[model samples]
Target: MSTTTDTAPTAVAAPPVPPRGGVTIDEWHPEDEAFWESVGRPVARRNLIWSIFSEHLGFSVWLLWSVSAAMLPRIGFDFTVSQLFVLVAIPNLVGSLIRLPYTFAVPRFGGRNWTVISASLLLVPTLLFAWAVQTPGTPYWAFCLIAATAGLGGGNFASSMANINFFYPLRKKGTALGLNAAGGNIGVAFIQFFLPIIVGGAGVFGLVQAKDELNLERAGYLYAGLAIVGAFAAWLFMNNLSGAKSSPREQLAVVRYHHTWVMSFLYIGTFGSFIGYSAAMPLLIKINFWNQPVPEVPGIGINFAYYAFLGALVGSIARPFGGWLADKYGGARVTFWTFVAMIVGTLAVIVTLRQLTPVPPSEVPADPSTFVYSEATRAAVEANSTIFPWFLAAFLFVFAATGIGNGSTYRMIPLILQRQAEHTTTPETRRADMARATKESSAVIGIAGAVGAIGGFLIPLTFGSPWVTDPVEAVKMAFGVFAGFYVVCLATTWFFYTRRVTVAGRAPALATADV
Candidate 1:
């Protein structure tokens, strides 16, 4: 959790830290050991707790469509698989776009103020979701618009991450960022785990039957209550640091750095995959295993509900540990290995899909009684029985690898910036050097965050609308593309961060001198 930037300050003592009035703090210095022990830790911890709660709720609302869309068919909606994919995918698209503006909001408005604003915005999607499902004859375009509202939650991650980045010292960035992200990531799992029971169990615990046989609207109403609580908690507990304030130019300047784009590309592979797969998994199970018979149970069977939550759950839980590993081994090294696993995991899924085959007919029936054994029939049977386990295992590995990569890549960001600053700056004082490096790293986080989110949208769209007509084939091809993309990311990470190059007649990797 420590950085190479550890250095003692100049002989002169720092000014007395000012007391906070309301949510704003006029003075802050986390790198100042005495100041941090007395003031920084307490305020940062308070803010972190509320930030995680709000961001967690945001994530749940953003991905709520994943469950709602899957239940549409049984609840009397007649949308095709392609249409449903679009419905679920729209939030990721909108969320990705919203992140750029949301990243700046923390500095423009104070962190505490922006968090309240962002948390309150979740109500739009939750309310729209309730109304949309209750009304019949809702057009595809209308659903698209409603889903887009959910993107507000996605933006919370950017703002939350940016805000928390200012709270911790360089030494603890990995753990803090990982915890924040893992908290948000768990929202996907929570929604997936509970939404089914709420929608299918009639009421909570099936105490009373929900209005419809499959009460999809209940999912919307459920999250609406939680969003309000989250907003209230954020307003009550969080504080803004004066140190976190910055101009738009200062924040956006990270775009000019080559390293920002490199990290962004790597992040897309890790985070984009985590989210995309989590959102798409339920529908994938339903679509591919459409003919699989549900076993006799109190609730709906074989709807993919049985397994959908595990991917997000495992991915979320693994994230912090990934960050811890990065802290010990270096981010670039951990990330490179993560991409290797992602490539293998994705290819395994593709192999399972391509290998699918039907049980052959003993003989063709005679005359009018002849039984037809078509390729379509074979594909369905194979999908339900033989290929299901392999597909599931392959995807779960993809989730795990992405989760680890998520942590490792994030840890790299600040370390990379710290290195760059140290190499360029000739400051005689330690505090000045630390200040400059912190500012640059915070800027790059926002830029990289926005770019990485695009992967969430791109992945679903790729699988949803492949060049080929067959949905199964489309999925196979999409996995192949993902595998290829990982290879590119792997190479990119090594060349830029891990691979050593001679500089000024000495051999050391870029940023290693002060990472």
Candidate 2:
């Protein structure tokens, strides 16, 4: 009965006017433990909604450069293709590396406080971007610095997932976390989709442009605006749900689990696919599809690319759905199939690119690309392009499957840890303590999460191929390699618990659903 659209923000519980005895006052209230357990579902659900919304905004702002980087020439920035990719890659790189530290921040400081800190940091990069863009004389170093600031937004994902993990029962952590993550990821697609509209429809920087200055100020200001709104929302409605602290030593202790490493690799497969394809969407479209371009300022390239939005959109929407599917079936069941599907999707792309790409020394886009047609290509043949559908399908399957894996893996982790913990404990104590599983599960969550989030950066870099002769052949080889990697991962799942464990979340197997 409850859906995001069905939940009314105004109907949610109101934060108290004044602070009460160290209570976290935000969108959520963890003031009463009993109340949180009994009446907290609606409240947490509402919080999840807002949390996703704010986190979503964070992703959008973080990815602003990825969208804008595509339009750099229109903005008067003379960036090379490689340089542009690197610029887009910067946020992902820093964000990936910082995930561990960000995961830890919640335990050190309250989640409420960290949310504000992380959310507020977004302004620095965004405004810096705006500032750098305004100064026509600004150097490349300045742009790079501003772009790097966007990395701040990327850290929000790890912390957000970490905080939310403290809020749920192990049984529901998958769905709850899935909702949170999917909601946040929607930001990536949204920004990519809307930035073009904003620029194309309203002359994107229209609000910030002065006759004498470059109008790119809106790019940063737009991010600043989203950051401001998220901060205000956090201050208004977010709650600090604390507990689940293991000392730094305790957290480092979770790294000992082999499960952590296995899942990390799987993450590089699923979430990596989501992040990699998302970043690659526009370039895929621009190089492959016909677009209408407009002349902006003489020195800059400013036209919007229309076809790229679909890839990110499909990827974003599929994530939560995948999580739901995993809940119904098993994480490994869905994940294995999903991984298999990703390979298929990539193959489709490889085929499409080879077919669409122009031949060497042929009339194609002015610059060389990853795919070039071997035979003379016709406009009618180009009209029938497979790149769009294949790329879109690849992302859709990847995002959804990643989400499913997220849930199932989340479910499996606590269960796996519980079984392992019980093996070390005496029967009477294990029977007496039902809560042990919940506690241990919570402890390992941040570790797995921090590891998994790295996929966001790794997948993109994985897809970032070396320069190639036949753009088409090179891309084929690259995707073929990626697809092959997925196959190995699927094998790992089968070898591990999934093969013999016969768990409930596994195919037809029923293990206790503690996770």
Candidate 3:
């Protein structure tokens, strides 16, 4: 009895508290197994779901111009082909420029708060689009400015990615981030697929009847309503983590790492190609395939709207697969192979392009209002029609490769930064170094995203090629250039990550590091 009275009491763990709505979490510990199982999982999942929704809508708005530009001629805008291409490229350019600021915005304003604000800002672009389309005699310059506002949607990608990076532990981040990105990337396909039906341009697989004329403003209004819903959803359902604080200077420190710049360049090949092709595919189909006479089929041509969404859909679906493969085989290996595939796909596209003949300027009507196909133009169209399927197949292959590359390259970023951190840390400082690595990786994601998006702008401009007399010739040249670029990307991936390398008598290759 005297020995029993001297025994110490057992300690019990406290019950987990349920996550509160619209509040900052003061103490977050995703890496702690007990904490993650009891509380972190549900909270992180809720944030990820809403983040994906808002970002998905943002992508829809950003790419509204891509589909809209193809329809403008139908409504009597009478703009040149180059001018229409400019409309599509403007949003991409603006979107790329704003991504850096958008990335920093997550830490400054808090994820939940910034998401609401960013979602609300989408109203500016949607409403402007509605006004521009409905208003008679809108100037080209005015349309350019209106299109620039759509870039607001592009910025949402960087911020959403950066914010979600803070919510997951390293083991699960790849899958979580892949789903988030895939959701947003699919927005391009969603708008391209649905806007035609929504605006009464074409029926869904001929299920619905198309309007005699397009009501383009209807698309703007529908997306505007969704943006409002996205904002409200974030305000009601999302939470912010208090521990996810960092100054711009702290985040910007990632720029000092050589890997950051290298990753950004590689990203230009993957994400850049994905987005650039998404923006241009509709128009590319329109210019090359639509209005062309099919062989043995009188008075019938390909409908660009019917097939334009496929490229984006295939790419979006392949993105998650890319991430999975990277997880199993390593990112550098996946990325190098993806670049090789892209190069092959691009060359195949050029081969398809070479088999067709385009209508000369003399055969094309100066005013679309008075357009009619000449016999020679009809023959050219008929010849081109036979090769359209081949062209589409080649482009789709490239899209799939880009999607895979996008996922692999993103997965590589976190592993690379973590390895770098391990190289410099002692056992006593391991925890602190890991935490810093997470922050740096998140920052690098934003930087690479911003840089990669510039390709979206450049690709469309290259295709448009206002200075060139022959648009088809310009396209062929562009494909050749793209193939060459992918080869360079392949070499870069091999040299820096895939091959064994010695740095000051230490093995520093990412391949050897198991990243």
Clash counts per candidate, in order, are: 1, 25, 0
- Candidates' lDDT values, in order? 0.80, 0.63, 0.87
Per-residue lDDT for 1-515 in model 3, tens only? Answer: 35545667888978697596699988787889888998989999999999999999999999999999988877768688889889999999999999999999888889999999999999999999999998779999999999999999999999999989888887777777888899999999999999999899774655766677789999899999999999999999998877777899999999999999999999999999999989998888877766632211223356777888888888888888888788788888899999999999999999999998866443435553455567776687788888999999999999999989888888889889999998899999998898888888989999999999999999999999988867677788888889999999998888788877655665554554246
Q: Better model by lDDT, 1 or 3?
A: 3
Q: Where does model 1 exceed 4 Å of error? A: 1-22, 201-212, 292-301, 358-383, 428-433, 502-515
Candidate 2's residue-wise lDDT over 1-515, tens digit each?
87565654667665434332225544332335555665566556656766787788778877877767766665667865556666777777677677778777776776667777788888888888877766768777777777777877777887787777766654566678778887888888788766665554233334423233335567578778878887777766666654444456655666777776776677767766666667756654544453322223121112234545555666667666666666677666777777777777767766666665452243445443333443334343344353456655554555555555555565566556656776677767864343444444555665565556565555444444447533334445667787788888888776664564544644322233222
Q: Which of the numbered candidates is closest to the native, going by highest TM-score? A: 3
How displaced is residue 309 in candidate 1, in Å? Answer: 1.3
* TM-score attained by model 2: 0.79
**What is the TM-score of candidate 3?**
0.93
lDDT of 1 by residue, 1-515 (tens): 87688688779966555444246887788877888888888778788888999999989998998878877766557787788888888899889889988888888898889888888888899999999888888887999999999999999998899889888888888999999999999999999888878777332323445434666778888788888887788777888877777788876777788888989988899999998988888888776664422112122223477778889988998898888889888888899889999999988888877776533333444542344445665555655556678888888888999999999888898888777776767757656666756766766777777778888888878888745677777777788899999999998877777766744655544634122
lDDT at 488, model 2: 89
Deviation from native of the Cα of residue 146 in model 3, angstroms: 0.7
